[model samples]
Each structure stands twice: as C-alpha cells, then as structure tokens.
Target: MTAFVLIAHGSKNPKFQEIVLKVAKELENKEDVKRVYVGFLMGKPSIEDAIKKAAANDDILVIVPFFIAEGSHVVQDIRRKVEEVVGNRKKVVYAKALGDHPLIVETLYQRYLEAVRE
Candidate 1:
C-alpha cells in the first residue's frame, strides 16, 4: 500500500494543524490514496513521527509539501528528515510544493474574482 504524508510548517495556532489534518482526511478518500498522514516541522507529530507511522505498513510513501513554494524546509529539511527515518526501507516520492500545481493558479484567480466582486 502507498501512504501520503502532508508536511507543513507548524503554527502555534491550533487551527493550523486542524487544517492540515482536514486535508489529510480528504486525501484518504481519494481512489489511489490508501492512507494519509500529516506532520509538522515545528510542532507535535513531527515529520519524523508521521513518516514512521506511515512506513509501518505501507511500502511506498509519497511526501507532499503543503508549503507555498520550495523553500528550505521542502528542499532540505523534508528530504533529510525522511532519510533519517525511513533510510531506504521504502520507496519515497516527493511531490511539488502546493503553489507549483496548476490548481493553485485557478484558486488564486477565483479568490481574486471574489475580492473584486465584493
């Protein structure tokens, strides 16, 4: 089975983690997604812990950065942390940061339209 892990820069506000978890829940319902986990760089259930939990049964892990762009956390920290935890035990794939996806562009346009309408 393959698991999807969403890595995010944690926030002190509880709502931040809740939103990440909500995304994970949505992913779990996707046809190809067998499992979903959320981890943070700054808070509880750190990236290491999330990967460990995901790797326990799944043979492949797809790490998706929820960051706006490929910042230091996505470019370096995420890869280093995953390596430290899994260490080639399973196939690991990295997805582009959220902002890189075309859907984000559409979302941005929609938000802009909404702002101008109000």
Candidate 2:
C-alpha cells in the first residue's frame, strides 16, 4: 500500500488547511493509491507526522509539496524529510512544484470571467 502525502506550508488562515484537505480528498479516489494524507509544516498533522504515516506500509510513497514554485521548502525541507524517513526504500518520489501550467492559466481566466459577470 503506497501512501501519497501532500505537504503544504502551515498557515494561520483556516482556508489554507481547508484547501489542502480538499486536494487530498480529491486524490483519495485514484486507483493503486492506498491512502492520501495531508500535512503542514507548522500546524496539526505536521510534515514529519505525515511522513511517518506514509512510511507505515514500507512500500512506495510519494511526497508532493503543494507549492507554487521550486523554493527552499520543496527543494530543501521536503528532500530532507523524505531522506530521513525512507532510507534505501523501494520507491519514494517527490513531485515538482506547481508552476506556470497552461491549465492553471485557463482555469484562472474562466474563474475571472465568472466573477466579473456575477
């Protein structure tokens, strides 16, 4: 059973946590993914905790940093955490940061149009 851990920076704003959970929930329905976990660097279900959860199965585990760019959090913090937990593991992959994707631009444009019309 592989665990997909979505890591996000903790924010005082409740909306941040809500958004992370929403993303994790959406990923839960995917096939071959045993579990989808959400964690924050600061708040409850800390990044370390999430890593531990993903390490439970001792199988493939993917850590996805929910960041807009390839900053220190994704480059440094997440890398260090993955190394600490899954030492010489079978499969541990870290996804790249979400950057300038065409889908994002299109979605933003569509949302903007709706907001203006409303």
Candidate 3:
C-alpha cells in the first residue's frame, strides 16, 4: 500500500486545519491509496514526524506539498527535512503542488460564470 502525506504550511486559524484534514480524508477514500496523512511544516506533525510515521507502514511513500509555485519551502526546506527522515527507509516519491492545472482554470471559469449569472 502507498501512503500519501500532504504537507501544508501551518496556520493558527482552525478552519485552515479543517480544510486540510478534509482534503486528506477525501484522498484516503480513493482506490490504490492505502492511507492519506497530513503534516504541517509549522504546526503539528512536523515534516520529520510525518515521514517517520509514513515510512513505518507503507513500502511506497509519496510526499505532496500543498503549495502552488516552486518556492524555497518546496525546493530547500522540505527536501532537507525529507532527506533527514526518509534516509533509505521507504520508496519515497515527491509530488508537485497543485499549480496551473486545467481543473483549476475550469473551476475559475465556473466561478466567473456563476458571478456573471448573479
């Protein structure tokens, strides 16, 4: 089974956490995905801990960042942290952020159409 860990920048607002957890739950329901976990760089389940937990269970681990653009957080910080924890544990795979996808454009278009209707 493959365990996917969605890493996000932490926020104090409760709603922020709620949304992240909600996304994780939705992903977990998908097939082939054994479990979907979440980790916050700044808040709970630091990157290190999350990787450790994921490494323990699944043979395939995929770490997905919840960022749009390729920034320092994705390029440097996350890489360093993952390297430290993963250390030849599980088969680690990194997924790019949700950026410039056709679905995002379609969603925006739908929103615009709704606003125009109103």
Considering every candidate listed, which one attains the maximal TM-score? Answer: 1
lDDT, residue 115, model 1: 100
Better of 1 and 2 by lDDT: 1
The lDDT for every candidate, in the order shown, is 0.92, 0.82, 0.84
RMSD to the native, candidate 2? Answer: 1.8
Prediction 3 TM-score vs. true = 0.87
The predictions' CA RMSDs to the true structure, in order, are: 1.3, 1.8, 1.8
**Model 2 stretches astray by more than 4 angstroms:** none
Q: What lDDT does candidate 2 reach at residue 68?
A: 85
Lowest summed lDDT across 10 adjacent residues in model 1 is found at 96-105
* Model 3 poorest ten-residue lDDT run: 85-94
Inter-residue clash pairs, candidate 3: none
Which candidate leads in lDDT? 1
lDDT of 3 by residue, 1-118 (tens): 7889899987889788888889888988888777877888888867788888888888888889988767898888888888888877678888987788898789889999999999
Which should have the higher TM-score, number 2 or number 3? 3
lDDT of 3: 0.84
Ten contiguous residues with the weakest lDDT in model 2: 81-90
Cα lDDT of model 2 by residue, 15-106, tens digit = 98988898888888888666787778879888878877778764777788888889998999888877886667648888877777787788
